[model samples]
Target: MTPRQRRVAIVLGIVAALAAATALVIDALRSNMVFYYSPSQVAAQQAPGGRAFRVGGLVAPGSVRRDGLQVRFVVTDTVQMLPVRYEGLLPDLFREGKGVVAQGRLAADGVFVAQEVLAKHDENYMPPEAADALQRAGKEQP
Candidate 1:
């Protein structure tokens, strides 16, 4: 092939490779994306049924129950509440009436089966998403 044709072929090959790489990156991100929802959103059935997602809110007071390694609690945004079940050690900061974010899938029975639970690290700090959810639910944290 002529020099110009060789250059054109090289450019086309690079463009094709870049497109493939971009597609791969986008696919990976899409698959790994986990959305955040509030208790109201979950109650409205806006969260994905079978896919993993995050729910953030305040742990309802007097709602935590522990049975062996399994723990159950209720997360609420004041407007609505969601039941969450987790089977593992909880964070030291986990407590009732505090901010929490749980990652899991919604069970067929309407319970959130949490794979991981994150509590607010400090008394003065709550996750932004959790705070927003509460505000949207017509409650303000102290």
Candidate 2:
């Protein structure tokens, strides 16, 4: 082959390799990525069953229950509530009637089996997801 032809072939091979690598990366991410939702969003039943995801909302008042490291709470957007279960050391800000986001799966029973729980770090701050859910629910800051 001519030198020019050889160079063109090498470039095409490199391009093909890059395309394959990109596709693989995208596929892997698609499988692993878990989306965030609110209690209302969870109530909509849009999440893929048996796959992990995140849900954020206010910890419903009087919904916090603890059994040592295992905790259960209900997250709410005023109009809807999602039960969440987590077994781990919770953040210091975690409490009843606060903002929380849990990463886990929506079980067949319609509750969330959380693997990790996150709390808002500041008193004046709420998670954006929780804020959005509250806004959608027409909840006013009190």
Candidate 3:
């Protein structure tokens, strides 16, 4: 083949490889994507029906109950509430009326079975996803 033809062929091969790589990356991301939703959004049936996702809001006051290592709490956006069950030790910053984000899937009983529970690290820093959710619910952290 002529030098010009060889150069064009090499360019086309590189483009094809890049396109394949991009498609693989996008597919990986799509499968791993976990969306965040507020209590109100979950209540309105906007959360993922069967897949794992994240729910964020304030831990409702007087709604935390513990049974041995298992803890049950209600996450509220001031307008709606979502019941969450976590069977593990909670973070030190986790408390009633504090911003929290729970990553898990919803059970058939309408309770969130949290695989992981995350609490704000400090008094002023709420998770960005939780903060945005709270803001949409007409509330903000102190």
Candidate 4:
């Protein structure tokens, strides 16, 4: 092969290798990725089942229950509610009638099994997912 043709082949091979590496990385990350959803979406069965995801909404009033290291609460978007089960100590900001986002997977029975729970940092600072959910729910309200 001419030197020019050999150089072209080397470059093409390098490009193909890079593309393969990128694809592999994306495939690996896809499994680890967690999507965010709202209680309304979850209630409507729009959220993906059996995958790790985030659900954000207001903590429903009178829904917080604790049993030693385990806690259960209901996240609501005013139109729908999703039950969440979490283990371990909750953040100080976690409370009823507040915004919260739980990262986990949905159980077969429909409850969210949270691996992590994050409460709003301040009264005026609801998570973006929670705010968007509330807005969407409000617009859908009759």
Top candidate when judged by TM-score against the true structure: 1
Q: Looking at model 2, which ten-residue stretch has the lowest summed lDDT?
A: 133-142
Instruction: Estimate, for each residue in 45-137, the C-alpha lDDT of model 1 and write its tens digit.
Output: 999997999999999999999999899999999889999999999999999999999999999999999999999988799999999998887
Error of model 3, residue 15, in angstroms: 7.7
Spell out the clash pairs found in candidate 4.
none
In angstroms, give how far residue 109 of model 1 lies from its true place.
1.8
TM-score of each: 0.90, 0.88, 0.82, 0.87
Give the Å error, residue 105, model 1. Answer: 1.3
Give per-residue CA lDDT, model 2, range 1-142, as digits (tens): 9999999999999999999999999999999997888888778887777789999888989988999999889998788999998889999999888888899998888879999899989888888877887887899643
lDDT of 2 at 8: 100
Instruction: Give the Cα error of residue 137 in candidate 4, in Å.
Output: 1.3
RMSD of each: 1.6, 1.8, 2.6, 2.9
- Per-candidate Cα lDDT values, in order, are 0.95, 0.87, 0.92, 0.90
Indicate whether candidate 3 or candidate 4 has the larger TM-score. 4
Ordered by lDDT, highest first, the candidates read: 1, 3, 4, 2
* Comparison by lDDT, 3 against 4, better one: 3
Residue-level lDDT of model 3, residues 1-142, one tens digit each, is: 9999999999999999999999999999998999999988898898988899999889999999999999999998888999999999999999999999999999999999999999999878888988877787776565
Q: Which residue runs does candidate 3 get wrong by more than 4 Å? A: 1-22
Residue pairs in steric clash, candidate 2? none
Clash pairs for candidate 3: none
